[model samples]
Target: MQNESSGPDDIASILSNPILNTDSYKASHYLQYPPEASAMFSYIESRGGRYDRTLFFGLQMLIKEYLCRPITPAMIEQAKAFFTAHGEPFNEAGWRYIVEHHGGYLPVRIRAVPEGSVVPTHNVLVTVECDDPQVFWLASYLETMLLRVWYPITVATQSWHLRETIRGYLLKSSDDLAQLPFKLHDFGARGVSSAESAAIGGAAHLVSFMGSDTVLGVVAANHYYNETMAAFSVPAAEHSTITSWGRERETDAFRNMIARFGKPGAIVSVVSDSYDLFAALNAWGTELKQAVLDSGGTLVIRPDSGDPQTIVLQTLRALEASFGSVVNGKGRRVLNNVRVIQGDGVNPDSIEATLATMDQAGFATDNIVFGMGGALLQQINRDTQRFAMKCSAIRLGDEWHDVLKDPVTDAGKRSMKGRLTLLKNHHTGEYRTTTLPVAVEGDWEEALVTVFDSGKLLVDMSLAEIRSRAHAHEG
Candidate 1:
């Protein structure tokens, strides 16, 4: 899609397009915003209404359309009034000044892993360097967008790791030739601070992995996944509850649920860990499996309690022993067809531990699935796992100043000095060292580049494309 456009004409024209109503761009909570009224007019009038197609338009769309918060007329009018009071001639430099001075654009050099590359701890994921002496003061404001981009990269990296672990288990236990049909569901909405961040977090996972259940993630993922892997699933709630009264009452309630949504051939998932997870699994496992199979449907059982490895093993064994290994006329085995999904407190460490435990217990990994919530999406986020942002070098007068933070605390937290060069190890191909200025600049290639330019995406990449890139890099 074209980058967001500036001026009332472009906004008006683009808003009229019917394609916005599609599943990808549906007006969900993350897409809804208070209408911009005289704000546009006021901003135009203050600047002599001369639209030079500024990059701010793209930034605005990211903030307003994508973020989808209350951008009230009052706020817009206030911004308009501020711009009118400080309006300058319309030009790239002038616009840069306006943004830098009032709109807050600080030139900070950011060194980050390539968008889809997997990164580890203490690995300097990004280094933001500013030429201005006072740019350090604005670091907190930049934190919002900086972390916004970085969090997804971190989450995607973790997801990639967890998926690989699962895949390895599947290869060892199940038919290698059969398609696994994997999915990564983002369940971090509750843990995230706001709807916008949650959506972005979910979108990040989808970009590096597969479909997400978060509706906001659907919108964000649509920005990259509209043409590939177009379908996804949403859970009814964070957890399942038969009700608040009694065990028999809850069972009846659950039965009523199955009766109410008795659609044949539908893929339905239910969290089965309300009161005594094992008991619920025992009670509902047989009936739910038979109901789905008998009706030509598929039942995905989600267990979100106790040890994941143990629960999954027990659940799978029960299903297989109870249902038998007979494939229906539709070529779907009743035992193999029922998927055991594990959610609640799933992270890289937990995923690895679960896989190791399952392997040790001799359980088939093919019968297991995962729905990562807080651990994958929220916990190891950029905010939690921070990359250092430091001023390594600065130009003062005629000489270049090489600055270093004196090691008064942790050595890992110490900042390096000079305009350093990151060298890739010739043998391992991993980032080796941060060398001094004496190293040849010609040998090192600039890492960060403008992926988006002139109000348009310079590079068109789908989520699958990014995942393929990540997989190739991994290999």
Candidate 2:
């Protein structure tokens, strides 16, 4: 990458901007100003206010393009008022300060699996460096973006794999593949850490598949794409009560629920493990079916407490016997209109196992939906994933410094250092890593290019565009 110093005019323009000097901007609230601003004013004066231009450029671009921009002036003003009322000075600095004061800049290169690539554990997902001796401090902060960007990708990629596996089985078992459309719903948000993370993670998963998030992931996804997102889902219900050792429910409770939701072909999820599931199915199943049909809705019996494969098979058979008929527009016979959804302890391995059992018992997997919760979000232990990241190099005075971290206990925790070049194997198409000298004795244009320069983003991608890129790579 070519390196250049920020000119006087550029520096002047940056300093003169109102956003840099005043608390009127919400970003300014992150600055360390006010009483400290007076003390730091001298520090600013002493250094002529010239920080790392390259770092500042990157920070500015991120704030402008990624973090905050569509934020209204009213919102900024509101934040300023709130901070002032709380007696907290709105003094803030961008990531540049975190990067520069923390470490000196060294030339670093990063190689990652294109966003949608299905990556396995122990892979060197990303590599970083700085071009100057003093800029190595920047490596620490990169984790904020690196982890944030990559974790959701990893989780979504795994979810997509599971969906693919399930779809394969469904296609094989179903008599008419065209009758059923594959739909994957995201019910993991309630189990996630925070609402924002859930939305982002949910949206990422939805990019590769389909889902209905408890929170507003669809809206956030639209903003990420810079366009409207078109997504919908089957309206669903939760478990209200369970009978002891039976599937029977108080008829009044069921009647009340159907009335409130105005059942319009909606999915009513009931916990069937409270009683003998078969007895519950035999007694209440017929009444529920008639009530659902009368209400212009279809009953989706959810067996949350029994062996999923067994419950699904029994429910399908019972429904077929009671309301047997020829196939409808949605493909399955009228009896299949009342579907089966299984939840609780539904992990990838368990799902696979359940599908095998269903196949053995001659159950139509297409007639059921999977409402996964904690298993999809938190069940996949990170220890099993074996994901690691490292900064392998720094640019020294006319040379490259190699830095490697030897694993202490875990075999997959080691990292390779030095200026490394990523090469693609022509035949196998796998990435090959090679160490290189910091300085190019000859012109090598392919070696490095400016992605983010002087704190400005040269490449901007819409969410839809990125999603399309991900899908294309999968193909």
Candidate 3:
């Protein structure tokens, strides 16, 4: 977030000094890779189809952080000492050039499958290019920044998979498919590593779902993707809010929520597992039945413990016995003016299991929603989707070279080669890689677009556009 006026002779640039790896030197970068290579074309892909597709995200933030921001001379001087202390060789010449000309703009072009595209694993998600071979260190220097994208994309893919899972059950269980988008709620902000992680991971979840409690995720979506309002949250009470009122006044806590947030269309969620979930549900249906019914708004009961499938079904049964139920067109029971939200022990697999059980029990998907915390945001890693950014093609002098790594020990680690273009296999509506640089007429449309080239962001994507694009890939 700083800029430099004069060039650094002895000091290293602030941004490029701290490398994630010990041997991440621009001058001696990727020693095993081609040294004469002037241009490095690195691509990101998932090794297999663990999920439907990888969502392209977080690169906008990466570009904003490093390339677009001004690099102050003072920041570079500070990093120089840190670099020496860390024993990681810094590329002063390469960084100094960036600081001088492009205002810390990284001298690289990153073309990729658009963010929110449901790209199949083993298909190319992104490609980074460097024009000058001598200054190719900048390409490797920025690898750390780009690799951070893997987790966010993995999280997005995971969330999308769950979305499709919920979508299928919704179409079968209820006639109103509009409610499918809000079926999965995000509560993973507290479970993540940091604020930025919460934001990035949360934003990934939002690409598929509309309900979230993470404010940082809302902020991340707005700041990075340029959305006016990214996610929605209803008035909800946590354990602290309810427990603070004392155990004897538990009914009063429930009453207070109804009094404050209860309206014709306002939905309020209450966490009911502080003491007894069934007891509280009974009290709401029997003792406080009139209060909830009189509110005229939907009350979403949140069961935070026990097996989510069992707890949700029991809660629905209790609600139907007291508040009553109406049969949907799909022969599933829908509780009147009430719903259940399972926030605890909810994940992609668990959600699918819960939905399947609910369907078997003659219950509609409209009667329930899921809130995922750690599993939705924090339970993923770069390997969740096996995302790897490797140099598949290199340009040296005037001749272009195809680079690849084939290890006998692990065939999955083998990388793709040559000037790659992501093409849609028309029959499957899925993406595949091709060595052809240009799209053949009527054969395939190029999936990779010039998102960021040189010092400018070529494509400006909106979150709404991204969400539509994401859902378009749904089978």
Candidate 4:
């Protein structure tokens, strides 16, 4: 978190030195390439896993945060000292060649499908090549850092798919899609491994929905993606705030939340299952019903534990009995002012199941919202989308040769050959991946654009722009 003005001691303490961010073996890779090799080309793709399509994102953040910075001699000295004792041959000359010639800006060119574009699996999402032949290993050396982008990309893809799932149910059971964007809220800040994960993954989820409790995510969007405000949250209570009031004073604690946050035109959430969920609901419907209705704002009830599908329906019926409900034109019942949110054990699968059950019971999808924690940000892995960056082509003595891996044991692991480019067929609206030479022969629109070039960012996309591109296919 230190600024540029921080002293060398502060900078050295941080583990983000670009040279040291890669796998240890990579330090010796420059010596492993063919002696005649002049340049190398690589591409990244989703080999195909959980989702058929993948959302391209987070590359801008990576480029700006890690690649754009100039590598210093001090960092090189530090890396050399570490690699020497670690039994790896450090490419001191190759790195100095970059500092002397390219001024330490990475001599690499990156072309990628515009961020937020949902490209089908098995197609090239990004291509990387060294801008300087002398540093042919530079592009591949960055694979460790660039490939880390898989985290944000996977989170965005999952969030988008979950949005589509919620949209379908809303169409069938709700009167309109007005509340779709706020239906899924990010509650994963506390569940993630680090602050950076919370910021990156939280920003990814915001690409689909606008409701989030992760404040750092909102800050990330504002700082990285040029958004003023990316997500919204309301004053809400947690288990501690309720339990702190003593079991006997639980009703008083509930009333205090309403009095504090339930102003007109506002929404406040309160966890009501501290002692007994049914008992609390009875109190709200009987003694506390008038106070809730007179608050002039919506009261969101939260049930932290239970089978989400069963509990959501039960909670909806209880709210109906207390505050009453009305059948909308869609023929689904909606509870007045009061609503429910299920925060525990929530994921896309659970949300789908609960909504399906509610729709079947003639209840609207708008009756409840979802608060996702660990399952939203931390549960997925790189293999969740089977993301991989591979050397597809290399240059030796001015002749470009195809470099690929096609093991018969696992054909799914086969990689592309030659320099790659992604193209979208104008007539069919389908995407195809082909060598750069072949891309010129078809009636296709280039899907991959130059996003980064030799220490410069060519495109800067905003969160609103990304959100729009991500949902463009829906229309």
Candidate 5:
């Protein structure tokens, strides 16, 4: 299929075509529904996996990027031709009807929990239904893209849990929580599968921490979440930068980094394991200690090799032995001008172990930071929280019927029934999932608010507001 506008425009059009965005199996689903079927309802939830609560996010980004655009004839023709060859049935009449009657805007309504709110798993997080009876299949058709929200939601939830764990350590061993935001830094950009994954997953990590080395994540948050600057990074050295100086000139390389970026109040990270981590520490403490102190900046030493839980404490003690330490009001040892960042083998378990070791050693949590890469962005999957979108209710001939899946083999896989609405009691501050007897009405507030309707964005959230909600849940 071709368009009047060629090349990039055509590619963009084809890539952005919502009709073609779904699974090939969905292309044949429009005809499989009952002839009297006029509306279909489906909802997404975490069927209970890694964490108890999930942080709702990424829907606004999906809506603005994919659903808001009106479909075109070229897209319909493209999908038809592709589906013909791919052996899946195409709904040409359905596509043309949507284009002609609804101006190509999908006739669907999306209600979702507000982004950044952390709610218990196995509860409805988002609900989809067709607004136009003529397009009863639209709701499930969009599931292919809508369910991708699980990626960001999982990343955000995991990051929030990491923050809570770190906060607990800090509270136990430190005098202040001022440095909490910069504790866990995102290093997942290069580790993600795609640019979109890096952008979305990186932005999701920003919901918890203010530190990140993923520039694409910062750009994503600014573009999609309306934040001026969602996260920040300091000048940091990589293995290549340190190793480039040659083993003989490693000291010079470290000095050069301090000279270039070690201004007052600035923090610079240097990967010290390029040669011998202990030897490098000795040099920094003896030969380079004065220069480091005179530079009026902090040097964050990164130990990228060895066991994280053990190496982190050793790095802290070595730094203290070189620079010495002072007892803070909290009665924990704070290293003088040096800090440690454990960037290798970092995960939730390792982070907790490292912090526990530090606490037992009487070191302040403020003396070290963490940099997470693949585990933060690429390691999680839909099953990380058992995320699923299933049809819960369908309308046939003016009668609504509950749709459910009760797998006797696995009771945990049993799906919800009927139209569902998430309700929160203000008096008790508790949330419950209940079946809506009919269309939602009256003063009974529903937690699931309409965020998208017929190609229009009903709610646009910012990163700052999202971060606030995510943090507030912990309180």
Candidate 6:
């Protein structure tokens, strides 16, 4: 974890970890549209979330790892092992053919809803194309790679919703709009599925937030999006940090935090519910009031247990009574010098409730920030957005065959047919899906932008651009 290496050494060491393109199933080589047939796949649809479009991510990682490089003998050996494990025929010919035909690039044109566009449900997010009929199979091979985008996209959309929610409350309850982005802190990293998930989900949150503790998210934003620093974290204490000081000296623990991190205007958060919540509040109001006021910084008290809403309300009332309150421009009671952050049991619903309750109590929304964990990241699945990539049309022989599945049992499983075109209605600003002949011309706002083609990254989107679009609700 402490390796201080760069460039060749890091890439060499990291690349040593085997790459698994899960969707490149061992049987995919054989299952592709026959050599005699041609096909185009529309990597269509994500059916959930508040945002119309998903934050397109993970493609660069997939392309760099699997497409940019040539297939090695080691890769073929691994493929063989896969075939043996699956009890299927080894696809030496198919893979070799792929290498010979593909050279060192993915021979497909991927047009997608721009990185941060508001893509509507049932509209094509991505369309896959290849001039070579035999290359149609590559579409499914890349499914696992591209479909994985939903995780980050869904998380980004969820965070965006939370941001919007907070923004609304803040607009109504407070005058400060600039601090809205940092309202919801990302505390979900440790609760995610993996280091990669943490990086992706945490970065997604950064698209709508500026507060984060997941260092890997910083690395990911920089590495993938050309960002110098997408997020910042304040020095804060955890349960262990406070508990290590012992319950007998909890007040001292609070003092030590002020002494060390007491920079004027610098924020430091302390978990205050280690023992008796009420006692801690009493000490913070009486014993710690002078330290907090004189520290020239904001003291964020974190209550990590009990009912989140109730605890938040109690904390707010207690702090207002003890530390006193200041009336903001909105004529609301803003906690003086100190704020409470409810980190436990925080989610979109609870955050909304907490803000509403705070508003009703004549407290400004800016009086506190939110820290969310499991519900922020791992609580969602693919179905949360109903995301799926499928073949909307297939060309076989000389005819364009429209492909769709109209399941009798479920209409939601049904798909669109024929060549698909995503169009933006200029007036209503909503997206519309249409089928067009390959050479058809019409008055349409072409929605899908080419992202990757023939092993080249046609577009390298920056995190800043995506964040701007996402925040502006322009894309």
Query: Can you give the TM-score per candidate against the true fold?
Result: 0.65, 0.65, 0.92, 0.97, 0.96, 0.91
List pairs with backbone clashes in candidate 1: 109-129
lDDT of 6 by residue, 251-285 (tens): 89989999999789899999989998889999989
lDDT of the candidates, in the order given: 0.49, 0.48, 0.80, 0.90, 0.90, 0.76
* Model 1 alpha-carbon miss at residue 204, Å: 2.4
Clashing pairs in 4: none
After superposition, candidate 3 runs with Cα above 4 Å error? 1-27, 30-36, 101-103, 425-428, 473-475
Scored by lDDT, model 2 comes in at: 0.48
Better model by TM-score: candidate 1 vs candidate 5: 5
Better of 3 and 4 by lDDT: 4
Better of 5 and 6 by TM-score: 5
Off by over 4 Å in 6: 1-20, 23-35, 49-66, 438-444, 473-475
Q: C-alpha displacement of 283 in model 4, angstroms? A: 1.1
Q: Write candidate 5's Cα lDDT for 103-137 as tens digits.
A: 99998989998998888988999999884678889
How many residue pairs clash in all the candidates, one count each?
1, 36, 9, 0, 0, 4
Off by over 4 Å in 2: 1-113, 120-124, 132-134, 148-150, 175-183, 241-249, 252-280, 294-297, 325-335, 408-411, 421-429, 433-454, 458-475
lDDT of 4 by residue, 29-105 (tens): 98888999998999999999999998888988888888888888887887888899899999898888888988988
Q: Against the hidden true structure, what lDDT does model 4 obtain? A: 0.90
Q: Of the candidates numbered 2 and 6, which has the greater TM-score value? A: 6
TM-score: model 1 vs. ground truth = 0.65
lDDT of 5 at 404: 97
Candidate 1 C-alpha lDDT tens digits along 183-232: 45666777777777676667666644554667776676665544444337
Can you rank all candidates by lDDT, best first? 5, 4, 3, 6, 1, 2
Off by over 4 Å in 5: 1-11, 438-444, 473-475
Judged by lDDT relative to the true structure, which candidate is superior, 1 or 4?
4
